[model samples]
Target: MGSAVSLRRFPSPEERPAALRVCRLPGVYAPQADTRLLVAQVRHEALWPGVRSLDLCTGTGIVAVAAALRGARATAVDVSRAAVAASRLNALLHGCRIRVLRGDLDGPVGRERFDLVTVNPPYVPSQDARAPSRGARRSWDAGRDGRLLLDRICVRAPGLLTPSGVLLLVQSSLSGVAATLDALGRGGLRTRVVERRTEPFGPVMSARAEWFAALGLIAPGAWTEELVVIRACRS
Candidate 1:
C-alpha cells in the first residue's frame, strides 16, 4: 500500500477514553492505541504484491484492508459471526476486496495456503467472567494461562503456510512471551519480535492473578501488562 502510517498515539490512560469510530466494519469495538501500532507494523513489512494473504481473527478487517490496499488478495477469518460480518462490511467501505470467513483460525480457509498470515489473537489470562469486554471476550481472552488460542495457532501454523510464508502475531508478555516463542519453535517456526510496547493491565489480568493465587499457581507481584508483536517463519 502507500507508505505505512503510524497509528500509535499517546493519550493519558484516563484521557484514552474508548471512542466509537466506525471501523472498516459493521458493529463497533474498542479501538485502542495498540490497534494503530499493529496497522503500522504490517504496513512496514515486505508484502509480496498479488500474493495471497490471510488475516486470522480478522475482527473489523483492518489488517486485511491494509493488505488489499497493498495489492494482495486478502482473506479475513474470525470465529465470531458479528466479526465476520463486520469485516466484510469494512472491506466494502474501504473499497477493497477482502474475503471474510467465519471460523476459528485456519478452519474456514482449509487447504488454502498464503504468502503471509496475520493474527491479533487474544492474549489475556483471566477467569473472571466479567473481566472481558464484549469484544474482548470473543476476541481477546486466551483462557486461563492465556495461551489457549496461541498454542493452537502455533501448532496449526506450519501446515497452513506456503513454503516461504510468514506469520505476524501480537501477544502480551503478561501471557508469557517466552513460552509463546517456545511453542512456535516446537511447531518448527523461528520467531523474532517486530514490535514491543507496554500497556496497562486490563481487568482480566487482575482476575487472572487472583485466580492463580487462589490455585497456588503463582506468588504475588509476578504478573504485569506488556505486549509484543512477533514475526514467525518456518525454520
Candidate 2:
C-alpha cells in the first residue's frame, strides 16, 4: 500500500468501466469521489487480519467491505434502512464478512472500540435548518452549517478508538475542514488533512452552488469544490 494508487475516478462516461463492481441500489448514495478518496486511504493503512474496523454512515458499505477484503473484521452502521439493506447485499455480493447494522452513526455499537474507523456521513449544507432523520435526504441533507453529523463524529469518534487507533473522515471543504480539525484537535487526537482532491460539482452540489455563493459559502462562479480526507490518530 506504499505510494497509494488512485482508484478509478469516474468523471467521464468513457472513463468509467462498463461493468461496475459496486452493487448500488436505488436511493442508496452511490460511491463517488469522497468514497474513492477514503477507500484509497484505507488501502494505505497498516491493517492486520482480525483488526477491528468500523464504518460510520456506511451507505453501501463499500469502505467496510474493502476493509474486510483486506483481512480486517469490519462493521458498518447506517441510519437509513435501505442503506443497511444495500450494505448487507453488497457485502454478500462481494464475499466480504462485514457486519451491517441499521443505526445512526455509532449509536448501535455502544461502547465498541476499533483499531480503525472510517466516516463519510451526510455533510452537505442544505437550506433546511433541521436535517431529516429518515428517507433519502438523510443521505446528504445536513443542517444549515453542514456539520450536523460531522460535529457529532468529531466528539464521539475519538473516544471510540483504541489507544493506537486512527479515524479517516472524508467530507467536502465547504462543510468546513478547519472546523473539523479544530473539533478533533480538542479531543486530544493528532489530526491533519491527509488527502485533498478537487472535483467538479455533482448535481446536488451544482444545484446549491448559487445558494451557497449567495450565502457567502463560496465565491461567485466557484463551480468546483474541494473534498478532503482527515486522518486523526489517537495520541
Top-TM-score structure, candidate number: 2
* Position 54, candidate 2: lDDT: 98
For residue 231, model 2's alpha carbon misses the true position, in angstroms, by 0.2
Q: Local distance difference test, per candidate?
A: 0.71, 0.86
Report the C-alpha lDDT of model 2 over 24-111, residue by residue, as the tens digit. 6667787888988888788789999899999999988888987888898999998887778878877787787988888878899999
Tell me the TM-score of model 2.
Answer: 0.91
Question: What residue runs in model 1 are displaced by over 4 Å at the alpha carbon?
Answer: 1-29, 128-136, 203-224
